[model samples]
Target chain A: MNGIGAAMRDAAEGVDVRAGFTGDVLRGGRRRQVRRRNGIALALAAVVGVLGFGAGMAMRDVPPVSDERLLAATKGDLADDREVLLTATVAWRAELTPSWTRDRGVTELRGEPHVYWASTTPVGDAAVVMQEGKVREQWRTLVGLVARDPADGFPKVVGTTNPEDPTAGTESFQFGPGDRTFLVVDPGIPVYASPNATRNPAGVVRRTWHEVPVVDGVGVWTAPDGVAPSTVRLVTSIGPPISDIPAERLLTTRPASAYLRSGVHAKRNGAPAYDTRMWNNTSRKQLRVGPDGPAPSPDSDLFQALEDAHMTDIGPPGNTGTWCVYGTSGTGGGLLVGEYADGDEPSTLFALLFRADGTLDRVQRGPAVDFGSPLPVRVRLPDGQGWVVASSQYLGIAYRTSDPGDWQEAQTGSQAALLPDAAVQVRVGSGTGEVVVDLPR
Target chain B: MAVHAAEEDFEEFVVLRSQSLLRTAFLLCGGDRGAAEDLLQEVLERMFVRWRRIKGPPEPYARAALANASANRWRRRSRKPEADWELAGTPSVCGHEEQVVDQDAVLRALAELPPKMRAVLVLRYFDDLTELQTAAALGCGVGTVKSQTSRGLARMRELVVEVTR
Candidate 1:
């Protein structure tokens, strides 16, 4: 033990001292060159989009939704049959290739199409889409649907009715015309309207996105009085307890390809859903799901499970590692979801899996789910073969080995229905776990 | 005046942190010279445009950018399993000849730690940063730094014990 500690210390010290000089020298020189290139590029873009600078600056102050409003929106009730359309011209850096200067386009909502949607209140299966208009770069001539099941907070690509080829070579999300339908059953924070503008220290016109810290209250919807609409006004002066105070928060404004290449949207059921072939960043390696496997499909239950969650996890993926896997049942019903986590580590992934549900049936270490954060964390699964999750959040693929480990004394109900097509064999660090599902292959 | 103006320029910040940033990269890459170099380049390019105001210290920003980039790489690689890696050697055991131990194991253990824990450990052990410095680098209180460091070290030790045994 003593020798071990000393060795560890020596290793750490050696790493520290060696990394210091080498990392600096190598990193400094290479980074300087890259930064220089980028600096020149940004300077050129600024010159070209000079007109955009002021408007872009003007758009900056568009108020953000408050926490109270977020909470209130969560609690808003729409009758079982009520649904309404939510539309907004979101302005962010396009998450697509060539990274548009900035996005200033309208996204519209109607109840999940093909479903009888009533009021605009957001609910479990509600769907909204960004309509076709001129984006800064390639034109999206038709309506493009980005559907979300707030119930699970997973989002899927419904379809691109728009003409111009917008996002290709990107990790495309498929939402069948009706496959990704959502029901907006509740009222959310009314769209916030900007109050006024302020001048900058440079005497340039500037505005900040501010929201009033008021409790639940609905402001009149003015933009589309002709259409069913909802809108509200918020001020940032009220401060705390009433609303989410405005602070500089990082809103992702990168191109969609950049985001996709990061694999932030990859992985499910603890198994690698997408293959590295999908990775656009040739400089970096794509996350290995299970050995050479088929690509993800629109019919994929893994994709379905992700769509169930709005495509946004509770927190950043770096915080909690998600454990997932596909499993089969004797009755032919398959399970999609397993234990899910919000932290970015293997233990957190395992802890979330074994949290009394036994839904994460396997005891074997599963493949690592690397959330884009500091350091890659291996998402581990419990040992066992053919583990199934009742929910998609816990789906993970363990390395190959199908022995059912000791079953804990826990709730056993109608075993989870598994999807057959999704059942797969996954390997991790030389170990294998069998993912048995009932979905058709 | 040029210095002040340059300080405000995003490019200058990237240049300033390049070396330290690379060092951070080297630590995260488990001393894999090639991967570390590649990771450093990717981050530097990312910080190139936004060099002006990445908010926190350039080092932390760089570290974070590297971490996120690496994590993304792993996520994609895990899904595809296509990156070809030559076997450096056999897995190293604890108390075994120093030459035989797996450097990847130590790295894997470190990588397995929570992002925060791993970050704290890297700052402390790899970078040899003091507790206060680590806290400052991460934008947290000293307590968080201390607790995270202790947990990370313990986790690393556990991995070592499990593998060596």
Candidate 2:
């Protein structure tokens, strides 16, 4: 045994146990069984009553569910049935979560839920059912549907729970096998799908967000078979694409192709501005590959400092011990790097400027997720490389930095950028007006 | 018939793994037998309820639940004063007297770490869980398990020094 193992073994030695402990455990098992059975029985009874209510008034004409109500519903429909809507309401108010919300118990819902909208897509006869329930204290208005296969009469549940963030009025959820998905957004939230969103010469992944109208916050459209939710965006229907929060919350802002070719969104304090996804998908939709520094090769020493720092687990999975080099260093000899880290020690964003010899030439740890501070952190990289700017808030879009120019999207997710050197500092425009990520001299 | 069969299997699993789990639980609670017993019994009882639904090996599930519950239940009140890891430095356990001293120091030091950090170390070292396995047991990512292990060992050594000093 190695030192820790042997030491642990010795430390864990000589524990005493009572003879009747096993028997006590067995008894506890019976109590648990009763609790579980009672809980299930109660749940079943409530669901059965709701089902009966939906079926009983199957013929009653009902008005449309409020646009707000749709955001908190559990299932969706292609066509709205008034009875179904009422039944869903009863269940939501009573907090009786049906099988729709519990596992993929779509087949277990007694019958099809309130059909709000129905469509014949390549996927099949997709009926968006508005299944509403208060699951586990959160109002999970799932954007789900019952798709009756044309070949078989069986109905399958598609989509998932509503956004956990109550303020997140729009979210994409996949319930179909693979990545086939549906979306739930606030009513009239303009949505789009880029069958093929491509990056333009400007170095931003531009998507012609073809507007797909959302009725009561649910939109389902036809694609070949498997449509990736990443291709979806909720933006303005007009000419200029607007900064859409729902699009930002698409669980993806834009495709990963948006590389900031100019400045590093760096902070001397190691604050990271590494969000490639959010920066690309918005109306401000593009970041120019600025005229500065040598273009980063994949073999660049951006992560040399990360290696020096021994950050074994680099990023959210696929992001470790690799070069995600963003911008060119203005000094030309040095490579500026930004890496994200979160630990019990310190949740920080690192701005590492690696020397030609792969030493951490200059490093600053950025401030971590600050709920009170809403401004996006953008600061000049060492030696006047492109500035590094990123918003680390999880929910809201930091569209406008402190400076009121083109808004820098506040992103809770991760991004990596290398910017062009045309600008002195990134004028971050957010609701709070222009907040400058100070150029640390 | 199936219910009783499952019940029998559950009882057997508890009987076989109780002592080992209790030891893990003991270490997780920073060597508090009373707390370890309570944590194990609670976890096993939950296991007894969830035994049938738990696929494959039930030991992993029990261990996972124990680890998760141990981590979750770790609150500010239960925390020990921070160990001065830098001051403690690396422990050199070579001579018999030194080895005995190190061993005793290690136990005391282990008790002072945050419960989640200590649990990671215990699961990694004592239970011989791989990094991935430890992550699964703790309901965390493998990266977390790795970092926790590195930090835990470094902290443990520091505390070991502190104890011996």
Candidate 3:
């Protein structure tokens, strides 16, 4: 025939689909799901069973820490590195004085600490140990991380799951300042590593989310060399995401500054042109960077194009920002994504398509980012080349420096980069704290 | 998510995409519809088990898993070896329409190749995936995909010519 494609299509279409095929697939899938859920449950039970046995024996002989303290500490992702005999420090007093004792106005860390989930990290022995402490009079939980001081090799408390408040809402403790880091979350929280800041409304940004896999009550991640700690967000259902795991210190090794700031300005005839659209403030409100490439757009220019491409509903005026054309060789043109400076003011992010002759082809704009919302503003480039990533600040992407590759600056106002399919570790971020995260294969 | 919602999503995905995936499986198996249905079911079931944990849409993961699983299956069954077409014999193509004859002969040619080579062709040409997408689906290098597509087409041409003779 016509070609192998046509032949294959003809042959496949001719293959009759059996009745109840979808039902069969669903039933089989449900069976497999039940089996797996049972598997995780069984695995958790086994670990807890052994722990309970150990605690029982310990209670009968000496009772190092109370049964309540022991059980409380052992909760959350019950995976153990390896069962080890607890080398309980003699006597219940402070080994080196936990720093939290002297400062708090209300509750102090009381009762002896119990080292529960101790495992060898990429660095040294790290543990998700706990000690009983009262907060404001209520016996609240205090979670802490134990790791070698890295400075002198002395095992010290690096960080703790922070709620220290009357109530705990998915608190997290991330250990870092090295090549690899460990993290622990208080079970019920759904966590993702995301970009730092996205400008709102007039200059919105598309934030990214890569699920943080928690093992043994710790988030398993390693910041590649020469990068900063990735921002982690606790995605809540109804509202904006709670930005957790602040970029204080993590294996990313060094701290990066938030250098994203630019108002809607573009290059026109070798000079600057600004998006004098709704709530235009890029002129006085930009940080150090922002909507700087493709100047202000004609709304109707991007309207029909965006609709035809099934990108966005580009009606009258809502979102306004600068747009640029990149990857000219691709059909129609490259991705048209825009972002804003890291300011909370009402700014919008827009994506535009244009011809080589500076003619407008398509336009897309929206609320940009709903921080607490799970919806992602996405644009799949034509012909499966790649997609776009937008944020408030400039971004540089590359395979890990720890592995091999240099950071390439993302496209101008698009604030986006098209990651090639072969990359392993793509480092995408800027002053908003660069995170060298794994590109899930 | 609650158990019911997860089930709903898994069911939705299966009903929506299983037909298309079944067709892909059919081509990968050299037009064995029964084998294709079974292969698709196995992959969909596996995806169901991981429905909640899978972020975004499950199509990408499903395709990749299908390609990889299909290769593994062929590898496992290859130890015993299946009967091959008799290269020395030529069946008559006279009565059948030219298009029908070509379709049957090309499918037979596909069945003659190694499973991975067959999978590479199906993903690249039939599925209309880019070289990179094909490579990713099969967890192989783009170089491997390129070479496999070339060799598969050449071998199919030879087989089709011999069969028509």
lDDT at A423, model 2: 42
Better of 1 and 3 by TM-score: 3
Candidate 3's docking class is: incorrect
* Model 3 alpha-carbon drift over 4 Å, by segment: A53-441, B82-96
B-chain TM-score, candidate 1? 0.60
| Candidate 1 local lDDT, A1-441, one digit each (tens) | 223333334333322223443335333543454445445645654574665553122222322322222112222222122122221111111111111112323222211122112123222332223322334444332223233433344333232232222222111122222222111111233223332223233212233443322122322112112311111112223222122323222111111222223323323111222332121222222122222223222123332233232321221222221233333332223222222332222322221222223232222223333333221233322232233323222223232223343212111221122212223332222124323322111
Against the true structure, what is each candidate's TM-score?
A: 0.26, 0.33, 0.35
What is the C-alpha lDDT profile of model 3 across A76-148, one tens digit per residue?
Answer: 3323432321321211122222323322322444454566566666665666666555556655555556555
Write down the worst ten-residue block by lDDT for model 2 chain A.
Answer: A254-263
What are the candidates' individual DockQ scores?
Answer: 0.02, 0.21, 0.22
lDDT of 1 at A428: 21
Q: What interface root-mean-square deviation (Å) does model 3 yield?
A: 11.3
What TM-score is obtained for chain B in each of the predicted models?
A: 0.60, 0.83, 0.84
Q: List the candidate 1 regions with Cα displacement exceeding 4 Å.
A: A1-441, B1-23, B52-61, B68-105, B111-116, B130-147
Residue B10 C-alpha lDDT in model 3: 74
Ranking by DockQ: 3, 2, 1
- Over 4 Å off in model 2, which ranges? A50-441, B76-104
